[model samples]
Target: MQFGIFSVSDITRDPVSGVTPTEAERIDAIVRIARKADEVGMDVFAIGEHHNPPFFSSSPTTLLANIAAQTERLILTTATTLITTNDPVRIAEEYAMLQHLSQGRMDLMIGRGNTAPVYPWFGQDIRQGLPLALENYNLLHRLWREDVVDWEGQFRTPLQGFTSVPRPLDDVPPFVWHGSIRTPEIAEQAAFYGNGFFANHIFWPTSHSLRLIDFYRQRFEHYGHGTKKQAVVGLGGQAYIAKRSQDAYKEFRPYFDEAPVYGHGPSLEDFSTMTPLSVGSPQEVIDKTLTFHDSFGDYQRQLFLMDHAGLPLKTVLEQLDLLGEEVIPVLRKELDARRDPESAPAPTHRGLTEAKYGDRPVRRPRPNANRGDNVTGASPYQDSDAEATYPSLT
Candidate 1:
């Protein structure tokens, strides 16, 4: 299982210090956090997308691309890309650019975000959220695979012979994981495409993720991708750790009581027991995380929520140190012991490329000479990069 951290990019005030990080500080901190995750031998680093106050990650692709340049080996991805609001054409173009820039050290997770007013802010209706997500991803999937796209959808204007620039590196689009908290349609969509399903298992009961993952696995098999056990699955979790369990709670409690997401909803103890939030010693965090495999069976990725709820950058960095030095090493051993490599291997760019094209030359698309409107004429792909007739890769 791949292990790492995710950020919501929230700008919350630290309850203990009574000091909220400036937006600049929070942004810089996330960049530092991404590099630290790489330094610590973690596998993935993801940031969320939000367009409202208290959340600052409106442009996840841009931020992830920046993170991509600063680190190697870490799989840079979005905690949840807003599939409902962003133009699918832009997503296809921008992420493909990132894939090339990162040399395939990237993938993305898609979800209909929780924020409601964001729908109309982007000229979409909240009522049509599910349909928007479904249709948009369908188009995105096609955009990555097909060179010439002529599309007309309910939410977006028509496209005529459009090509999303910078065709995916190796002509293999980044692997997608559909994320959902409550909606099963998203799970169904992921399975239909033979993609991965991710449960944002933070701030919720494990049973919630269990049902969603189980349904996805069954549907994935029904669609003939693989057996139920072979379905691709990713899970989200949150934790705060220290040398002692008591210290962990004392440090996290103040932020827990006043932060926006789950504040005042349930007592911390009750919430921890009911959900995947683990505030404890390193051992406790490891022990709690292990139970997830027993509950959901073998899965592919595991991401932790480490930097949120008013935690200071220094403190969050310390948590990563504990996670890297003390927690993940043990988890890796335990999870590897239980999982067979062939049945549940890690997802990597090399692995996916080989799966798609084994011991064969990969295609490198060269765009045709410029054509106005892309409506009447354009050659979208060429085999060689040295040709003067081909436009530069976007």
Candidate 2:
């Protein structure tokens, strides 16, 4: 299984110090945190996207591209690409460029996002979130696979003979994972397209997550992607670990109490018991994470939330060290011990490209130059069936 960490980019004050980091400081620290994850042998590092204050990750491509330049092997991704608000056309162009720039080390997760006001801010209605998500992703899927797209949808303006530039690296689009916290239709959507489904289990009970994952797996098999057990799945978790369980709990209680998301609600101990949040030693974290397999089957990826709730840079980095050095080694062995031979591997760009074009040369579509240095040109469309895979204007 692939293991990594995701940061929501929340800029909250340290409850212990009452000192909040400046925007510049927080952004730089995130870069450091990502570098630390890479240094510690983690497989992926995903950054969240939010347009409002207290969360400063509006431009994920710019940030992830920068992170990509600094790291070599770590996969750079977004926690959510905001499918409802951001234009699908922009999403296609930006992430396709990211795919090439990262040289096959980039992938992304798409979601409708949690912030409701963000919809209106982007000139959309919050009530139309589900439809917007469905329509937008359908368009994005077509944009990546097809060269020129002529489409009309309810959420965005129509596109006639539009093509997202810099056709994906090796002519294989970056793999996408549909992220959903409580939406089964999103799970169905992922299964329909044979994409991975990620359940954010950090905030919900195990039973709730089990139902969602089971639904995805069932739908995946129904859609003829693979067997239920072979469907690509990913889960999210949160942890704050140290050498001892008591010590970890003592250190994290203050942050948990003051956390904006769930602070001042349930006791940390209670929350840990109820959700995937484990505030304990490395062994405890390993044990808790292992239980996911029992409930969700042989999942492909496991991502933890380690650097939130105003934790200092030093502490978060140390958590990564413990996770990479102490916890992951044991978890990997134990989880792989009784592996299913037919299980699918976690999605990656190199694997996807190879699956598409093994010994043969991968096609690269070079679009005609834009007449006005933009999408418009004498013919920006590559007019190549090899990449388009079907006729345009369908």
Candidate 3:
């Protein structure tokens, strides 16, 4: 299993102090949080892509590339690479280049972003989001795999023998995870291609996430990918932890109450009881997170929303330290021991390649016996055989 932190890059008021961070501060903080994640042994660090106000993460690749240059082993990823609006060709080229630059430490998740206004900003209709996602992803897949592609689609012009430059390093494309909060169509799409499904389960309750995951798992098997348990699954969570449960509540309550995502909605206690968000001690977070596996089975990746809601860099870094030191190790051990081998493991470039191409036998060139010259000869098998002959019995 892979453990990591994801930031939405929300720049909200401090609630208590009524202070809002500048755009520079938020961007710098995001970098700082990513570095802290690497320093504390987190497996991955993902940044969300948003274009509207109160959110700073507009270009995930730039941020992830910066993090990639600094970190050695941390997997750099995107929480949401917009599938509906952004050009698939750009995604294919940029990420492939980033993969080479990062030495294969990058992956991305695709989604139709939550904001409706972003559609027009990118010359897309919000009503066509699903179709856009499907068509764009199909093109993106082909751009990564085929050297040259001829394609026609509803949203974009036809491509005639188009080849995306800078082909993926070693023919390995960044692994994709389809992220959806409530859309079953996205889940079906992910399963259709045997890609990872990430239920951003931070907002909704466990039952809602369970149903979405169950739908995806069933569709995954229906598409003949594998059994339900073998379906690729990733989940999202949120947490605020302290040594004592009381301190956790006292510290996180103000932020929770003022958070733009969930603020003025459910009470903290009510939200925690209903959703995957944990506001308690380290042990409480462990226990709550364990319950997810119990309900959802052994998932591939678990990412927490740790640095959102304008929490200062110092507090976020402290949270990372606690998460690294107190929570992730125990969860890793337990989840690994309980995982099934037949199930698809965490989505990685190497794992995807092995699953797709590892079993094929290597073809060796056969030498020509008739060659009198002392030169290496090509095999007869190099060309298709029209027929086989048998020697005469005479």
TM-score of the candidate numbered 2? 0.95
TM-score (all chains, Cα) for each model: 0.95, 0.95, 0.89
**Across residues 1-394, which tens digit of lDDT does each residue of candidate 1 receive?**
8998999899999989999888898999999999999999999999999999788899888898899999978999998999999999999999999899999999999989767899999999989999999999999999998877889989899987677888899999899999997788999999999998999888788888889888999999999988888888898999989899999999899989997889988988998999999889999999999999889888889999998889998999999999998999999999989895555466777888999889898777666554664532345555433333434569
Clashing pairs in 2: none
Alpha-carbon lDDT of model 1 = 0.88
User: Each candidate: how many clashes?
Assistant: 1, 0, 0
TM-score between model 1 and native: 0.95
Give residue 240's error in model 1 in angstroms. 0.7
- Report the C-alpha lDDT of model 2 over 1-394, residue by residue, as the tens digit: 8999999999999999989999999999999999999999999999999999999899999999999999978999989889999999999999999988889898989998867888999999889999999999999999998777889987788988777877888879888999987899999999999899998888899898788888988999999988988899989999999999999999999999999899999999899999999889999999999998888889988999988889999999999999999999998899899679899988888788788989988887666554554655235556564432323555
With a 3 Å backbone cut-off (N, CA, C), the pairs that clash in candidate 1 are 366-382
Model 3: lDDT of residue 274: 90
